[model samples]
Target: MMKVMVMVKATAGSEAGVMPTNELMEAMGSFNEELVKAGIMESGDGLKPSNEGYRVRFSGSKRSVIQGPFVETNELVAGYWVWNVSSMEEALEWVKKCPNPMFEDSDIEIRPFYSMEDFADVDTSGEFRAQEDALRHTLSLQKASLNNYLFFSGRCEEALNYYVQHVGAKIDLLMRFSDSPEPIPEDMLAAGFEDKVMHCEFTLGGAKVFASDGCNDGTTLSGFSLALTVATAQDAQRVFAALSENGQVTMPLAETFWSPLYGQVTDQFGMAWMVMLPAT
Candidate 1:
């Protein structure tokens, strides 16, 4: 089964800065009712005007800031719907019938949500798998609430290595294909992918780090990130400099009371990296 979210984009010409006309509102309500009756729709909602939204920024050693009155009118998201569908084809079938929210000629973006199976080389044979299943079941029962942080794919090895080499990370467990309990399956060996790391871990200043090299579909990383917390400003600076090499910095390392130092970067493997150290 697949979960999808349909996003309707509002354009300036189609949106005259007022509420929808009565006729359009009625049509939309009818469409929504139909969706509710179909049992495929999980949730839907219209957004408040974009001008009412604000961006929050956390500044180190300073008060947070809020910036509002968005400037990008062309990319406003008017509304969205979450649906449980069998396939992309099924999702498209529903989206095709959605009533136009704007005056006319509006565009909608349909994207699928990733399941645990989407994780590369995910383990399904132990206590961890059971915990994951239980959590997912709970979330589904609650209609899929949003999680504060999203998980990323690939780049785990590179990030861990960087931490070990530069941030004083101790390798607690490093399991490569050669280190597996059983021989590499014949099919897997024949596929020329057996040399990849199966499961690996690094203990960075008492925090456990995990990674794997299987389960990728050859796509670059997007829409996920990780946060790391350390012990001191010097430790944060050391880890940040090491990971930032050959990578781009999203936020420069700076002093913060939340931690003595904090920063974020995307490593050479295109995975986001974060470092934080406690204030003295």
Candidate 2:
């Protein structure tokens, strides 16, 4: 049997210490019942708000308290279930059948648990698994694994500046059309677009983002939006407001069913954005 953890995300309502509605509770209870009947759910429970928790930071041989109200809600554990499944694919199938855990858009992440068998190939002597596992625990931490990409027009440089100054985006790598090893297409060169941005990579609050100037044509976009997760209500509102300048507000920043501060906007560069404080 394979063991996996299915983690539920916290939302704005849950963070403010709001209890789930009876309907939501009933739905979740029914879902949990199904999992139990299938013998797939080993254990599960929700958690109190982050404010009720505390964190410890390590600096070499010393440790310090960071207190509650931690940032990175996306990285926080709201609720979780330990399941005995045959494979990752099987766990996902079960997750899909679960009720919507929240009243709004939410996410559930699954991760496999380490087992002694995992080390069998390393030495064929399973006795060392326990020691290695314990020693490795002192040096491991979660990491960033997702990013967004954007394709823009000739104004990519301007858009990059706007994000840098307003939303705290840091440019990591940028290459202009002239910097490319390949010559600019004859058609584009004749169109006076040789100076356009060719490619750029940046980080918004440590999340990777990619952008490029696609032929320098005016942007016409749809079907996807960039989501920014902030740490606090104050930062959410502040950043949302800053991004709204000279842009259209699709949704005004406000406390929503899912997030502490949530809103959507289409910036001057014609890109849609979802600025939010991580749910809960």
Candidate 3:
């Protein structure tokens, strides 16, 4: 419920460009991973040596600039993390578990961030709080999103099940022609296609995609292929096999100039997919 900034103080050795050893780096990576898995880590980063930085000082109507290699080495921050913890005690406990961040002895300081509630006495009109809320809303709106929609001639239900079984897609929503409050035109569906899927949403590879059985006009998916990127060659081969079964493989899975494993396949439902491991 409380946000805290944890700062790693720069050490003489760190300021002298002494880098962390592989073992220490691994330990820090593991520690950060643990923090993320616990959902307390908001953001963190290590800073470059202060010698490469600058400072700006301002007076009533004057400004002065100072280049760094700032003499007070101990006062410089080497890195910092913004974490949300239940209490200062929790933050202290987590900090105690962190590895020494520098080659030499170093200090880590934890300070709580000022919450909106702390300003209640100053902002009697609630103006600052309203502005903060509006900025937060704008930040949320700036998050981008994209979704893919697929149409099947009349096999959407079967295709959804096929995807769920083969590629682990999770169907979040589904509606049939009969589920519509307004009657579906007779010509819109072939004889037994009335029970087919009208619309459904599913997630594959962490992306939401839409699927539906459109009017039986014989149209099929074309022009675009869903790109399924996996982590390793083994996964790429396995998914390619599952998707290409009974379908044609435009490009057999093999080592490519771009990827370690790559291929193209048109699934049995006539949907094309590009299966590959991400290029290093």
Candidate 4:
């Protein structure tokens, strides 16, 4: 496995402006999604314009600093990606598919990273390689994150099924008020709500969310909203429309400064939702 750094050169327009158009941002996001699904991209990010950063130069023991809005835009990197590929050739093919990152003429350069193997002849003892292997594990796959918890008013099962069918969620675990091993208080559950969801956990987009049926009093959800990060603009559009059907549209899904398809809607059950293409 070869690791390469793909450097994106700054463009004139990007230096002057802070944001990219929604279409261009969405195109870039789609490209990033492809890279992530393929496991080619390790990490990537765009930079603030030069003025927000500085450069330091060293000569012998002395150092000097220079600040941005640097004179040469061509030499400044607007963004970069660290990709893992089989070879430089494979890396090039992936870069070729990237959208015009700056919404104008820009360039990307791919350079290989040095692996522990490259130091085999000089290090001889292999101590550095062992340390690297251990350190890298700290950055390995993490546990599933639980993001949001919802308490429903006896309609938990109905909302749970709606998410499972429409929002691509899978029930990981579920317990009914009747399924409780410990005697659940009658007041804890509403009358005729013995089969209502007592506690439920579900997975959506590899993240977990929790829900439960509590005190059956037609509760109103307020203050916070759930955000779904999808892979494509088409999916965002479709989901926004689906969530808005027979529901309230607080903010119509449209181009936003931060996202390609950004919107806020309340589902039929009054759960607020913000849907958008993944951030680039």
| Candidate lDDT values, in order | 0.67, 0.76, 0.82, 0.78
Once fitted onto the true fold, the runs of candidate 4 whose alpha carbons sit more than 4 angstroms away are: 138-280
How far residue 80's Cα lies from its native spot in candidate 1, in Å, is: 0.6
- Poorest 10 consecutive residues of model 1 by lDDT? 144-153
Instruction: Kindly give the stretch of ten consecutive residues in candidate 2 with the minimal lDDT sum.
Output: 137-146
Q: Write the per-residue lDDT of candidate 4 for residues 1-280, one digit (tens) a residue.
A: 8999999998887687559889988999999999999988889998988988898999999999988888798988889999989989999899899887876778999889998888999879988887876555333212212146677776788888899899999999998877776677557666788888766779999878867776565756414457676655656676678888899998898875456677879999998877766446
Q: Tens-digit lDDT track for model 3 on 56-160?
A: 999988999999888898889999999999999999999999998987788999999998899999999999998987576445434423345677878788778
lDDT computed for candidate 3: 0.82
Judge candidate 3 at residue 10 and give its lDDT. 93
Count clashing residue pairs in model 1.
Answer: 0
User: Which scores better on TM-score, 1 or 2?
Assistant: 2
Return the clash pairs for model 1, or none. Answer: none
Q: How close is candidate 1 to the true structure, as a TM-score?
A: 0.43
Q: What's model 1's overall lDDT? A: 0.67
Q: After superposition, how far is residue 2 of candidate 4 from its true place, in Å?
A: 1.5
Candidate 4 or 1, higher lDDT: 4
The candidate scoring highest on TM-score is 3
Q: Which stretches of candidate 1 lie over 4 Å from their true place?
A: 13-17, 57-65, 122-129, 137-280
Task: For residues 1-280, write the lDDT of model 2, one tens digit per residue.
Answer: 8999999987766666777889989989999999998878889999998999999999999999987876777677789999999889999999999887776778899999988776679857665975765454323211112245576766778889999999999999898887876566577642656777776889887678867766647655214467676655655665667778899998898776546777889888888887776554
